[model samples]
Target: MNARLVVVAVGVGLSVAGCNVAGSRLPDPHLSGRDAQYMALVPTADVGAAYERYLVDFKTSEPPGSIVVDTKNKFLYFVEGGGKAIRYGVATGQEAYGWTGRATIGGMQEWPRWIPPKDMLERWPHLQPTADAGGLPGGPDNPLGSRALYLHEGGKDTLYRIHGTNEPDKIGQSVSSGCIRMRDIDAIDLYNRVKLGANVVVI
Candidate 1:
């Protein structure tokens, strides 16, 4: 090969390699929002087999103006009308299980505080003493990873939240205390689309 041609080919190869690396580092499609505090890059190894069964495609058929949570399937469906829905993987209550009801999103916050209930402390004695001390500060380490949507019924707090989790592996599993947990990126995306007072149906 000619010397000039060799140099040009080497440059092209380097450029292609760079593009591949950049594309590999791109965030998952289910995550949205520009704030770094609301985003987390979880390792695929940690997530392992938990979400292996979940369908990655968010598009579906369920209709608009309604939310459906299928705990058995570890999926949350947002009806988008016209026989369509957006499915997201989720984590459900582990200890205090089997919650099925109708509720509305009362409010939402970014990186909200976590106040452990007395019951929770009692159930896990190791969490006693400081469990009722008003809670943990919001951050990446908090159980409520990035965003939180407080649920309510008849204008009263239901003590449940549709929130984010630091444990990406927990997605598509029953592993939370009582709240509904989602991947950080997916939760932020849902938070942006859902309005306060929107209906949520857990089944």
Candidate 2:
């Protein structure tokens, strides 16, 4: 069977209701080196097959290679044009902390060191210790799990990211402060496909 057949067999429905919280098998062809090693030890999340990555029939005006994040549905779409896109499950920001707007992928990193932003520290004073300690080093234990795509707006760092998350179980929930979170493996997959300065639309 061809790729299209495979997608059809896997089924393609971007709906968020009544999803099963069961782990889905995923491909790691893009993973390598430290990414492979660390991700191997991270347990797969039960985000359900609906939330698993898939090449689906999509309708969007965004050009191919651009990212459109549906914050409401907890899904992110990497537009592939021709009415197609690669959809990945995501953990978006909570209502009070949500951010929706256009941005660009100004920076990208693998196993990126995470320094809690100043505002984040202000919001949660307990994290001041981590901030004073110069933040957490990147690894499986870090909140920014395996990769980070820094979002920038108006040529300035927006302090928001579409990055890997240590809290994989939150994949389909609205739980983060503001950044978008993906499973470690999925982050690596997206990292491989995204290029610097690519457009990102969060809605």
Candidate 3:
């Protein structure tokens, strides 16, 4: 097989954002804002009780609304002050596909579009690398799902994001390219709560 084909095959099996997930179910982007569509997209796969939304007793000096990604446990925590946090389940990068360090939520969007970076295309040359990368527009199958939080450091785009993913099975699994992937509901909730310029620590 050609390199492109090899990469494409790998992507389909290892990552869900390449528009090729096993037993895919994506709704029209227009309905993304709806909560019903999210539960329908993956009926059997729930992020589960451990990953459910809840306020937990926690200790953190950071003020509320701060985002913390505990990739080892596949959980994202939104600091809610007073020794409390709203925890959400997430799908982090697989193996060596993750990123770390500190950044701020420099920007946010609803039903945001996805444009595969050049490095992404280089690894998966089978992808168009243009047009569709940006053309995939925000929607149910858009990979970005209902919301996105762009992480930046020192006012510069770090290219890492906390966003929504449609692939349900990917939840709690190391299955993304790099960005932290949360369910549509969880993402929308985070999007609604996280303040712009909020500190994000991916540890």
Candidate 4:
């Protein structure tokens, strides 16, 4: 073979080898690292639809002192009266469908830690240690992203939360274990507005 041709062949071989190595190390963009922590949580097709609808302008007629949670539609409306309501996109319970009735916002927190429930750990052994350890630290990576509003009824914790999620893409779907999740930014805005001990009516 010609000397120049032989050199070109060797260069081509090295290029092919480099391409293979680079491809192997590339991470899966579709699967987020935080997603692994919540075993039951998964992406749904409805999330995209929720985002689009939320952006569009619509007339809201809910009255003040009422909380309307349209789970199927993925919206949480805090009525401000006079044919107006503050609408917030939310992620609802994945398994516990259509939670109705009234409750109160017992407490609120910023960057709240997430403690896995006993039943959750029992179902998924991977969460055993974390369950006993108390909970995940409050941060961007935490499932509860920025804020949490604890729900109570008759002065007892209902174990339900209106909180923030790091998974902004999952907003507006039934994808959480049971908590109502909002985007981190939106939740922070809400956290500032809603007073503690406010009445919350879910529909």
Candidate 5:
């Protein structure tokens, strides 16, 4: 698949910016009891007011329930129909490892295990043992955090994911391998909403 530049719809407006007009973080109703409990144990970083989750008046042609990722803006929009989307801050891939295209949500996992890919192990040989041993288990210290949405194309795994990150400070930055990274809270929220076979467009 080839990457193409997509122009965002014009006249787009934000419906609710950063929890409230004051930009303070608040408990989200989307979070479950388990999600809240997990969050309480993790050390979270502020990703700035601009990157906070919000409900926006999205003017996108994509159908409702589709995910549109604006890598340039470090935002991921979950289309909610009726000109609205739930926008969440995300951490994208670095320049050398960036990927953009369309894929379906082929699989989903809660507290996914992390197997450092072959390339990643080659880059950092010290991780080879973990990879050989069947990767790291999912937990508070796991890089995959609370949930993962696997992207696939044509019935094949793309090896890229939209997953929760242990490093919340990385949100709003392009510092990942090739996957999209979100805060644990945001990941859980998205994971709960997204279903298998849902469309994901990253650009």
Candidate 6:
């Protein structure tokens, strides 16, 4: 089935509530190499929605360059204005514990190493690696895939991130530890699109 038809059949409100997308057409995924590998798996998922990256028409008043994350639906929308947007499937942390509200993109890293939070380590010390102080090095197998966007507020770190994941199939779920997880390729694409100080709303 065509991507647009597949989208409605899968029931994503035909284009998100209030999205007001002019049409149902969606562009192809922008990716290659490792990115393509992850994105390819997305279309094959059984989640019933076309969760792969889609350059869809979106209607919003959030301003261009702003990001709106619909955590409940596991979708992230990057408002491109003129009634356009890039939608990416995402996996969020536990509902009750996930980070929500306004934040800004404070920093980003490519192939960022994994840094186990203190509480996480305290709860699962056995997962700790003795290899390095900064945690696991960046790689295709690393959870932080190709990039990371650190979220912050008022110049302080929020400890929540929108980053790539090695687990591409998990993109449309609610099973993360408290971060926004994207396909490695999608993550890289988002990292490139977002700039420091850009506004982000998680609702």
Preferred candidate (lDDT higher): 2 or 6: 2
Error of 6 at 37 (Å): 12
lDDT per residue, candidate 2, 87-165, as tens digits?
8999998777788878899999998988878777777789888888898998888899889999887787878889998
Off by over 4 Å in 4: 1-65, 96-98
Top lDDT prediction, candidate number: 5
Tell how far residue 195 is off in model 2, in angstroms.
Answer: 0.6
- Regions of candidate 5 where Cα sits further than 4 Å from its true position: 1-37
**RMSD of each candidate relative to the true structure:** 17.5, 9.0, 10.4, 21.8, 4.6, 8.7
Q: Candidate 1 lDDT, tens digit per residue, 123-201?
A: 6777654555667877777788778998777787777888888777768678876678887767777777788878777
Tens-digit lDDT track of model 3 for 100-144: 777899999987877777667777777765556455776677787
Task: Please report, in order, the local distance difference test score of every candidate based on alpha carbons.
Answer: 0.62, 0.79, 0.69, 0.60, 0.79, 0.71
The lDDT of model 4 is: 0.60
lDDT sort, best first = 5, 2, 6, 3, 1, 4
Each candidate structure's TM-score, on Cα atoms with residue i matched to residue i, is 0.72, 0.85, 0.78, 0.68, 0.85, 0.77
lDDT score of model 6? Answer: 0.71
* Predicted structure 2: lDDT: 0.79
lDDT of 3 at 179: 86
lDDT of 6 by residue, 82-169 (tens): 8788888788877555766777899889778887776567667875772236688777767767789887777878788898887777
